[model samples]
Target chain A: MAELDLDSADGRREALRRMVTIRAFDQEAGNRFADGEIPGFVHLYIGEEAVGVGTCASLESDDYIASTHRGHGHCIAKGLDPKYMMAELYGKAEGYCNGKGGSMHIADVDAGMLGANGIVGAGPPLATGAALSIDYQDRDQVAVGFLGDGAVAQGQVHEAINLASTWDLPAIFVVENNHYGEGTPVEKQHNLDNLSDTAQAYDIPGVTVDGMDITAVAEAVAEARERARAGDGPTMVEAQTYRYRGHYEGDEEPYRDDEEVERWRDQDPIESFKDRLIERGELTQEEFDDLRAEIEASIDDAVEYAQETDAPEPSAAYEDMFVEQPPELERFANVARTDGGANGGDHR
Target chain B: MTAQAELEQETETMTVREAIRQGLREELERDEDVYLIGEDVGVFGGVLEVTGGLYEEFGEERVRDTPISEAGFMGAATGAAATGTRPVVELMFSDFMGVSMEQIMNQMAKMHYMFGGKAELPVTVRTTEGGGMGAASQHSGTVHTWIAHFPGLKAVAPGTAASAKGLTKAAIRSNDPVFVFENKMIYEQSGEVPTDEDYTVPIGEAAVEREGEDVTVVATQRLVGESLGVADSLEGDVSVEVIDPRSLYPLDTDTIVESVEKTGRLVVADESPLSYGTHAEIATRVQEEAFFSLDAPIQRVGTPDTHMPFSPPLEQEVLPGDDDVRAAIERIA
Candidate 1:
C-alpha cells in the first residue's frame, strides 16, 4: 500500500537503479556462463527487466511472489540478496537455497519469494494458494505469479486463475509476453494476440501494458494490487516485453531473424526509461552514468563474493528432504557420510 | 448424567460417512485455521455426500466450493499449507488424481524437502477410491498405492467407521502432507466410532481387526471389511488374523511382520492393481522382516491389473471381494 510513484524523482531514480542493476547482473551472468565461471544454463532477463521491477514495485515487501526460469530480475526486485543469488548461480553454499537450488530454483521464503520454478505454469497455483493463505489469515498482502507468455496456454494456469477468481483470493497473474516462448515466437504458440484476453475465462479484468514503459506496467500492477487488497479477486496483467538474449546463454536462436531482435533492442526498456527520466530532468547524463557505474560495482562485488564462496558439503544434499528425516534417509545419510559422499559429490 | 449414558453417547454407532463428517466437523470447530476446499464441497454437501451438512454448519468461508480446478486448488492448498492455514481439500475422485498429479507429486510432496524443511505442509487431501458403483475406469481407481509409494507423503486408507474418523482427525493434525483415500463403497458401512475429541489413529500404525494364528491378512481400505467377513465365514476351517494398515506410507511393518511371524503365513489384500502395488510393498516388507517365520508362499488379493469396467458384471469380475480373501486364506491356511 506504500507509494511507488515514478512521477516523483526518488521513485524514478529507484526504478532506473533497478533496471540498470538487472541489466548489469544478467549481462555479467551471461558473460560468466560463457567464460565457464558460472555453471548451468542461464536464462538472461536482459530486456524484460521492466516487467519484473515495475510489477514488484507495486507489491509490499511482505507480499508473496512466484517467478519463472528467467527470474533473477524478479528475485532482485523482490529484495532478495543479489550476493546470494549470484552465489546460487555459482553453486555456492551461501546461496538462497543453500546452493541446492541453482539459477532456476532460487527461493527466499522468509522474504516471501515462493520460488523461481523450472517447470512451466507451475507458479500460478502456488501464488493462488498464497493468496488463499492471505485470505484465510485475513492479511492485506497479495501474491503475484510472474509467468512467461509460454505458460499462458498451460491448463494449470487456467485452473489457477479460475480458483483465484472463484475463491475471491488476493492473487495476481503477470504474463511477460516477451514475443517468444523458448525458441518459438508467441504468435506461433498462441492463437490470441494478447495473453491478457485469457483472463476473460476467469471473469477478471485483464490489461496489456507496454513492458518497455516502466510507468505503464507499474500503474497496471498498482491497480491490480488495489483490486486484490479490496477483495475484488485476481487480475491478469500482460506485459508486452522482449528478451534480448536467447532462451539460454548458449542458444543458437535459429528460430528468429537478427532484424527482429534488433528492432526490440532499439526499444530496450532500460535505455528508453533512462532517456525519459533525463527528459523529465529527474535523471541527468552524469547521474545515469553514475547509476550504471554504481550498479556495475555492486554486481562486481556479488561476482567476487560468489567466486570466493564455498560449494555445499556433499552430505548436505541428504538433508532438507523432510522436516524430520525418515529412517530410510538417515540410513542413506549415514552411508553418504561414511563413503565420503556420492558420485561426483566432490565436484561442484 | 451417569457414566454408562455418557459412555454410550461416546460409543454411538455411525457409518463411515458420518464418522468422516464428524471428524471434519470436530476439526473445523477445533481450529479456525482449518477449512474445506474442493469442487461442490460446500453448497452441494459434496457429490458423494461425505461432506454433507458441513456448509450449513460452518458457512461458505470454511466450506469452500471450488471450480473444477484440481491442480489449481491442490497447488493452492500446498501454498496455503506453506504459509499458515491448514486446508482439508478433496480431489472428488482418486482416478482424477492424474489431473493434479503435478501439484500432488511436485509441490505437495516435495515442497517441504525442496524448501529445505522450512515448510510444514499441513494439508489433508481426501479423495474417494475403489470401484463398485459402475463409475468405470475414469472414476473408480484405488490409486492410494501411488501416494503410499511416493516419499514425503503420508497415505491413509481407512476401513471401518472408527478408522475413518480417527485417520481423518490424525491427518488434519499432522505437520506433513497426508492423503486420505476413502473407498466410496464403504460410506454406508457401519461401526462403533469413538466420539471423543482426542481420538486420532496415528499415522504409520496398523490396527488388528481380528486376532488369529493360522495366517495374517494385511488388508487396506474396503478390503479390510471383506477380509474380516472372510475370516468370519471360514471360522471353522481357517484362523485368519486380519490387520488393517490404516496408514500406508510410513507403513507399520512391525505389526504386519509380527502378525506374519505369529501366523507363519501372509495374504496382502488391497484394492489397487496386484503388480508393484501396496500389496507388493506389504508383502515384500513382511518377507524381509519375517521371512523365516513364513510357512507358505505369500498371496496377494487385488485388482488383476485392469481398470474398473463400466458394467456391474465387469466391475464385480475385476473387484476383489471376500471370496478372493477366503480363497487366499484357504491356500495359506
Candidate 2:
C-alpha cells in the first residue's frame, strides 16, 4: 500500500515481490493452458520478468506504457490486479476486458497501460502518439513503448520512432531482445548486430543493458525518462534478455537446443537478484521462500476466483463494437441473442 | 469575405471542397481538442486543397504536417484520439490505405472493442476516391467498400455539397472512428449547402434526391449524381426515383426498402467493384427487407472487377456513369 521508492531497501523488496508474482502467475497460466483449463493461446513472460518490473519501476503511475502480445508481466508490473487478469484468461465476465479481450489484449487505460496489442510492432506508434498528446497538452509526462526484437523489423516501428524523434516528443522505445523472435533467432531477422543501433538511424541516443540485471534495466529507463522530460526527444533501450519457455504454452520449439536454454537459465534474473539481496543481509533464504509461498498462494486465489466467475452472455459479443449500437448491427445481434451464437459459428 | 464565402451565402451554392473546409474550420474553432494532421495539411494546405487556409487560421500545432508517413501518423492519430484529443487525419488518397492497413484494421478499428469499450476513438480519416482527372490507378480507386466491410468503423461517402459539410462535421464529433470517403470528382461540383453552422445531416440516413413511383435507383458517391441525372432525363417514361445512401456501413436499409417496395424495381449503383462490394451490400439488404414487395429483379451498376487503368479512354471505359445507371434501370424497369 506504500508508495514505491526504487532507491530504498524496502522498494527493492517490493520489486522482488512483483517479479515473483509475475513468475507465479505465468507459471500457473501455462500449466492450466496445457491442462485445457485456459482457452486460446497464451504467450508467457516467465523469463522476462525483471525487464518488465524494472522498466515499469522507472515510470510514474501517470506515465503511459504500450505493451506487446507478451504482456502479462507488464500488466502485473503496472499494478493491475491478478484476479481480474486471471478471469480474463479464463474468458469470464469479471475479466479486465469483460471476456472480450483474452490474454493478448488485456488493458487498463485509467492506469495509463494501453491495451496489449495483438499485432507485432504496433505499440510503438501508439506510444509515440501518446507522447504527441502529452506535448500537445504541454504535460510533463512520458510514454514508453515496450516491443520485442522481431518488432524492430516492422516498418511502423521505424515510422513511429522517426515521428517521435522529429517532433521531440517525450517517448521511449524499449526493445526486449530475448535472443529470438518466435522460432527464428534475432540474427536471422535483423542485419544489425545491436538492436539499439536502430536509434542511430533516427538520430536518437540508444543503449543496451543486461536485461537480467534489474538495476541495469531500471537505470537505463530512468535516464531515458529524464531526457524525455527535458524535451530531448526519444531514446531506444534494448534489454538483452531471454524467454525460458517456448513462445507459447503449446509451442514445440525446435529452433534451439536444451543447452542454449540452460546457459540462459544459469543467469536467471529473479534467482540472481534474490541471491544478491540475501548477500547484502537485506533478506534471508527463509524470507525468500516465504515470499515465494505468499505469491503462489495469491496466484492460487486468482485461479479459484476465475473458475467461479461466469462466462459472458452470448449477446455480449455484439455489445462493445460501438459506443451506441447502430441499427446496422441489430440483425446480427438478434440472431446471436436467439441462437446463443450457434447460428453464426462461422464468425468466430 | 472572399468570393468563395460570398458565393456560399448569396446563392447558398458552395463547392464540396469549400463546404468541407468550412466544417473543419468551425469544428477547430468550437473545440480546442480537435486538430487536423496529415501529409501537406499544414503549410501546403492539403494536396487536394481540401484543407486550404486552415493552416493560417489554426497554425502548425493544430493543423500539423507529417513526413509522408501514413501508418505512423494514422496510428498516432488513433492513439491521440484514444487519449483526450480529437484528430481528423487526412489520408490523402483512399488507395494509399494499403500502406497503413495494419494500423487501420488491427489498431484503429479494434482498440475500443477489444478493450471492452473502455477507450473511445473520436478519430476521423478523410480520404479521396473516384476515377477522374487522369490521376491513374493508385489515386483514382474507390475503396469505400473495404472501410464499410470492416467492423468497428463507420464509412460515409457524400454525394452533394450539403451532405459533404454535414457528414464531415458529424464524423468529427462522433465518439466512434468514422471514415469520410470523398469522391475526388465531386470536390469542384457545387450545390446549395445550409449556412447554419449547426446543420448536420445525420449518418445512416438515405436522401431520396428525387422520388418517383415506377423504379428506384440507390446510388453512392459519384454515381449518385449520375443516377440523378439519368432519372431527370427519363422524365415521364419510367418515373425513376434516385436515392443517395450517404453512410455506407450503417446503411439506410429502411429508406431503400421503402423506396423499393413502392417502386417495385431497383438498381444499385456505386463506384466500387461489382463483386462483393457496396452494390452487393445494398442489393442484398433490399431483397432481405422488401423481398415480397419486389416485382422485378434487382440490377447492379458498378465497375467490372478490374483496376483503374492509366489511359484516360480505358479509365472512362470502365467507370460507371449516368449511361450505366440508365441502362440498368431500363433492363429492370
Clashing pairs in 2: none
For candidate 1 chain B, the 10 contiguous residues with the lowest summed lDDT are B1-10
Give the residue spans of candidate 1 off by over 4 A: A3-5, A37-39, A331-348, B1-10
Local distance difference test values of all predictions, in order: 0.87, 0.89
Which digits, one per residue and each the tens of the lDDT, describe model 1 over residues A1-348? 543557678877887788888889999999889999988788999999889889988888899998888889999888877889999999888888777778888888888888888888999999999999999889979999889999998989888988899878899999999988898989899899788998898899999999988888999999999999999999999999999889999999999889999999898898898898789877789988987998899999999999999998987887776554444465436445645432212232
Q: Can you give the lDDT of residue A59 in candidate 1?
A: 86
Q: What is candidate 2's lDDT per residue for B52-154, written digit by digit as tens?
A: 9999998999999998899999989888887778999999999999999999999989998888889889999999998977888888899999999999999
Q: Measured by C-alpha RMSD in angstroms, how accurate is candidate 1? A: 4.4
Candidate achieving the largest TM-score: 2
